[model samples]
Target chain A: MPKVTIDNITIDVEEGTTILNAARKIGGRIVPPAMCYYSKLKGSGGKCRTCLVKVAQSSAKDPRPMPKLVASCSTPVQDGMVVQNLTSPEVAEARKGIVEFLLLNHPLDCPVCDQAGECDLQDLSFGYGMEETATEDDRREFPVIDIGDKIKLHMNRCILCYRCVYVADQLTDKRLHGILYRGDVSEISTFIGNAVTNDFSGNMIDVCPVGALTDKTARFKSRVWFLKPMDAHRACGKCPGKVAIWMFGNEIYRVTGRKDQFGEVEEFICNECRFEKKEPGDWVIEGPRHIKRQSVISANHYEEMKKQSIIDPIAGEMNKQE
Target chain B: MKSLTNRSKVVSNKQMTFWERIYFPAILNGMRITFGHLFRRKATVQYPEATREFSDIYRGKHVLKRDDEGRERCTSCGLCAVACPAEAITMVSAERKPGEEHLYREEKYAAVYEINMLRCIFCGDCEEACPKEAIFLTKELVKSEYQREKFIYGKDELVESPDPAKRVDVSKRQTKEVLEFKKDKRYKHNK
Candidate 1:
C-alpha cells in the first residue's frame, strides 16, 4: 500500500489503484466530472478526460520531474505522490478544453432531449463552457444513422465517449461494437446493416454522455424537465443484480445500474432489466360516473355514488362483479 | 415506314410594327437584365484557387490526430465503430512493437484503418466515436474521384500533419521524470 497526498490530503491505497479510486476512498475531495467511469469495472479507461489531476512528488530532493497533469481516472497511485486538483491552472484549462470539445458538435437540442434535466454534459458545460463559441460555421453535417429498431442514434450530439461500447463489450460480454477507420473518419458501427438488438440496448441511451444515442420510443415524446423522477428499485428479472429504475409520472422512463451494490464491472443491471417497459395494463386507472358525467361535479357525484354502492351490499356486489 | 402529309393550313409570315419588326424594345430589355448582372459583383468562386471560410466545427475530410510527441493517439479501441451509424469504417488492431513507441502512444494501435469514402455519409459520427482524439474532420470537402476504387482512404492518407502552433515541447527532462515515476518494477512484469 502506498500513501499518497491528493489535494493536500493523505490517503493509503493499494498499488495499481487509480487516483479516482483513491480520491473516492478519502471522500472524493478532488472530484472530476467523469461520465464513463464505472467503479464496478476493471478500468476507468479515461475516455472522458473529465477527471484530470496534476501530480507532484512529496520529496523535493527526488530527481524525478513533476508529474504532468494526467487523467485521474487512469493514473495509478504511487508512494509519496502529491496530487494538486483545486485551482490548478493546468486542470482548469484542460477542463475548459474538454468541455469545449464535448460541446463542439452538440446540437444544442437540450430543450427537447429526455436527458436534459439530468444530463452530465449539460451541467458541466453550464459550469465550465464559454458563453459563446468562436466557431462560425456549422460543420459535420450527416444524416442521422439508424443503427437498429431499438436505438435512435443522433450522431451530431456525440462527443466520442466510449462508455456505451465499453459497457456493451467488456462488462456485458456483448461484442456488438468496433471502431471503423482512423482519425476523424473513425466511427462505431456493427457489421454491415445489422441493428443493435441487445436486450440492454436501452442502457446505451442512459449511458451516453451526450444526446447522440437515445431511446426510439422516448424520442420527441416527453422532455426531461416536464416529467418528475421517482426513485424505485426492482430485482433483476433476468440477472442477479438489482436494477434502479427512474419513473416519470408512473411511467418508467429509464433503468440504470444501482450504485452501492456492485462496483463498475457489471455495475449496471443486465440488458433485460434495463430495457423492460411497463405495458398499458401495468397502470391502474379509476373513475367514470354511473350517470356518465361530462364535468367535474358530475364526476364527483359518480364517485359519491360509487362510495354509496360500496356501503350498500347489493350495490357493492353489483359494482364489484361488473 | 414514314408517311408525309402534303395538306397544310395557310400560314402568315408578316413583319409587324416598330417594336415587333425591329425587336429593339425586347432586345433592350434583355440587354438591361444582362448588363445588370454583368455590372453586379460575380458570385462565382474559382474553386481550387479560392477557398471559402468554413466554420470551426465544419466537418469535412477526416484527419488523424497525433499527440504532443507526434505519436498516433488511437488505441484501436472499437468504440467509434460501435457509435458509427454507417458501417463505412473498418480497422484491424496491431500491437505496438518495442522500439516503435515513438510512432504510437498506446500499447494497442490501429494496424489497418480504411474508410469507404463512397459509402460514407459525412455524418461526423466517426469523429464523435473516437475517444483518443485520434480522428478529426478537417475543412477539406473537395474529395472527388473518377474511379470508385479511389474513394477508400487508408491510414497513410488519414493521419494529419502536426499543427505547429499546438505543438508542446516534451523535453528529455520531462520524459526522464515520467519514466522514473512510472518505474514500478510491476508494470514491466504485467506487460
Candidate 2:
C-alpha cells in the first residue's frame, strides 16, 4: 500500500491505484469530476482532461512537484505523493479552460436533449463553465443519425470522450463503430448505414457523457425530471437483470442501468433488459431509486416514508419473481 | 400561569349611562356622517361601462410568445412546469419534423400545453423561469367562463397569434435591466 495526500486528506491505497480512484475512496467533494473515465472499463481515461490535478510532491524520495497539472485518471499514485485538486487555484483555472474546450463545438441543444437532467457534461459545465462563451465561431453541425433502431446519435453534441467506443469494443462481440475522422472534424459514426447492433450495443448510450447518443424509443416522449425512477430487476440469461426503470404514472417510460453517485454504471445490462423490457409486469418493483437531493430529477421525489414502512411486501414480490 | 406580556385586558358587565341608553343622539350622529359621504367622491366605478386603470405590471393572463420570424419560441423544456408553485402548467413536447422548422424555433416544440387557470395563483414564476423568452404574463385578464373545463387553457388559448399586428405585447412586464441582458450577443440564449 502507498500513502497519498489529496486536498490535505491522507489515504493509503494499493500501489497501482490512480489519483482519481484514491480521491474517490475518500469520497465527497474531494473527488475530481471525470467526463471520460469509467472505473469499470479499461483505457477509458485521459481523453477528457476535466480531472486534472496539481501534484505538489512526486514521492517520498524525490520531493519535486510535477511541472504541469497531470490528468488524475491516468496518473498512478506514488508513496508519500501529495496531490491538490480543489485546493489549487491553478487546477481550477485549468479546469475551466478544459470545460470551455469540451463545450467549444457542443451545441446548445440541452432544451431538446433527452439526457439533460442526468447528463454528466451538463453538471460539469454548469459547475465550471463561464456564463458567456468567448468564441464567436460557428459550431460544427451534423444531422441526427439512427444507430440501429434503438439509439439515436447526435454527433454535434459529442465531446469525443471515447467512453462509448470503449463500451462497444469491450462489451460487444463485433465492434462496428469508432471515431471516424481526425482533428477538428472527428466524429463517432458507423460506416454509413451499417448499424451498430449487438447484445450490448445499447450500453453505448448509457456510457456517452453527453447527448451524443440517446435511447430512440424514449426520444421526445418526456423529460427525465417528470419521470419517477424505480429500482427494478427481471430474470434474464444474457446479463445481470438489475436496472433502473423510469416511469410516468404506471407506464414504463425507459429502462437504464442503475448508475452510482459518480454516474458510472457498475453492471452493463444487455439490450434486451435496456430496450425491450418496457412494461411494469416485465420486472419486480423494488421501491424508489435514491437520487441526490441536489439533482433536478429529485425535485418532487421523496422517499422518507418509504424507508420507514414496516412491512416487506416488495421483498415477498421479489422472491416470487426469483 | 403568569401572563407572557402586559397587554392582556379584562371584560366587565357595567351599567350604561343615561345618554348611551337613549341611543337617539348616536343614531343621529351616524346619519350625519353617512349623509356627508353622499357629497364625496365615489370609491368604485361601474364595471361594465366604466373601467379603472390597471397597474402596468399586472400579471393576469399568460401568453406563449412567437419569435420575430413568427415561429413559436417555446421548446417545452419543462422549466416553467417545474417552477410553477401551483403546478398548473403541463406540456408534451415533440421533435420538429423535417419542413416544420418555420412552425417552431427549436428542435422540440410543445405539442400540447395546458394551464389550469383556476389553480394558477398568477405569481409569475413561470414567466421568470422561461429561458427562451417564450412565456409571459400579460395585463390581459382571464375571462370568466361558465364551466370549470373552460378555465383549463389549451395551446390554442395560450399561444399568441402569428400575425404581427395581433401579437400580444408583454414588454411592460420585463424590467429594463432584463431587456439589456437579453440584447447582449455574447450569450447563446440571446442569439
Candidate 3:
C-alpha cells in the first residue's frame, strides 16, 4: 500500500496504482482527466498527456518533487508522494495546453454531428480548453471516409487519442489499421483498398473521443441528447443481449451496449445488436431507464414519492398505490 | 357620424338654377354616372377562379421553411412561440432520433408545432422572432375550415416537405433583408 495526497485529500491506494486511479479513490473534484486511458486495458496510457499533474513532493527516498509535470495516468503512486491537480496552477495550464493540442485539427461541427451531445472532446474542451482558440491559422481537415458499410470516419474531427486503434487491436482478431504517420500528420487509416470488416467495428465509433468515427446507420440521424435510452435484454449466444434501446417516441432508433453513469459501455455488444436489431420487439423492456440524470418521468416519480413521504413513509419507499 | 360629403368638392355649394334644380336634369346626371362605370375595369375577382394580389408586407399565413436539403430548419427553440404577440404559437420539442435526420435539421425538433389560426393576427411576430429562419409569413392563403379544431395548424400543416421540389418556396415573399437573414450560414454542423 502507498499513500498519496492529491489536492489536500489524503488516500492510501494499493502499490503500483497510477496517480489517476489514486485520484479516483479519493474522488471529489480533483479527478484527473485522461482521454487515452482505458481502465480495463493494460498499458493504455502515456499517449495523451491530459492527466498531467505536478508532484509537489515525491517519496521519502527521492526527497524531492519531480522537476516537470508528469502524466498522472501512467505514473504509479509512490508512498509519501504529494500530487497537486486542481490546486496547482501549473497543472491546470498544462492540462489546457494538452486539450488545445488535441482540438487543434478538430472540426467544429457539433450541430449536425450525432456525437454533439455525448462527445468527450466537446466535454473536455468546455472544461479545460480556451474560450477562444489562440491560433488564427486554418485548421487541418481530411475528407469524410467510409471505413466500412456501417462506419463513417471523419478524420477532421479526430483528436488522435488512438483509443479506437487500441480497442481494435485488443478486442478484434483482425486489426486492419494503425496510426499511419507520425506527429501532426498522423492519422488512423486502413491498408490500401482494405475496409474495416471486424465483427465489433461499431465499438470503434463508441470508443472515439470525437465525432471522427461515426456509425453510418446512426449518422446525422439524431442528436445524442434527444434519444430516450431504455434498458433492454434478449437471449443470445454470440454476445450478451443486454443493451440500451434508443427511441424517439414509438420508433426504435438504434441499440448500443448499455452505458453506466460514467458513460462507459458495459460490454462490447455484437454487430448484430448494434447495426441490425432496431425494432421495439427485439428485446424485453426493463421499464423506463433513467439514463441522464434529469428524466421527465423519473423527475415526476421522484416528486410524487417525496409528496407521499410526507403523508405515508411506507407508501413512498414501497411505491404501493392505494 | 359626420358625412364625408360635406368636404367633397363634387357637392353643390350654392343653390342651383331653376333648370339645373329640375328633377329631370338630376335624374339624367345620375343615369350618365351609372353608364360611365360600365366601361371601367371590373373591380371584382371571380371568387374561386381568380384571386387579388396582396401587398408586399401583407401577412397572410404562416409557413415553416425547409432548407435546400428539405430538412426542417426549426430546432424547436420556442423563439416563435415566445415572440408571438397574439400568443398563438404552441410547440413541444423532441430530439431527432436516428433515421429522422432527413426530417429535421438539428437534434431537437418541434414534435408538435401548432399555430392557432383563430388566435393569430398574422402579425409576423413569429417570423421576426424565429432565430433558425424556420418560421415565416407566406403569401399562401390559409384554407378556410368550418370547424374550430381545423384552425390549429399542426406539424402536418406547419412543417415543410423533405423534398426541395415539394417544399413551399417562401423566399419570394421575403424582403431582401429577410432573404439575407434567411441565408445566414450560422449554426452549421459541418463546414
CA lDDT of every candidate: 0.62, 0.91, 0.76
Cα error, residue A320 of model 3, in Å, equals: 25
The CAPRI-style docking tier of model 2 reads medium
Please give the distance, in angstroms, between residue B29's alpha carbon in candidate 3 and its true position after superposition. Answer: 54
For model 1, the stretches where C-alpha displacement exceeds 4 angstroms are A58-67, A172-174, A235-237, A259-266, A279-322, B1-191
Descending-TM-score candidate ranking: 2, 3, 1
Error of 3 at A188 (Å): 1.8
Clashing pairs in 2: none
Q: Which lDDT tens digits does candidate 1 get at residues A56-168?
A: 66333463636567887888877888777775778887888888876766766553355554567876887677766656555454556677776767666667677777656
Q: Rank the candidates by DockQ, best first.
A: 2, 3, 1
Candidate 2 reaches a DockQ of: 0.75
Candidate DockQ scores, in order: 0.01, 0.75, 0.07
Docking class of 3: incorrect
Summarize candidate 3's per-residue lDDT along A31-89 as a digit string, tens digits: 88778877755667788898899999998578698999999998999999999999999
CA-only RMSD, every prediction = 23.3, 4.7, 13.2
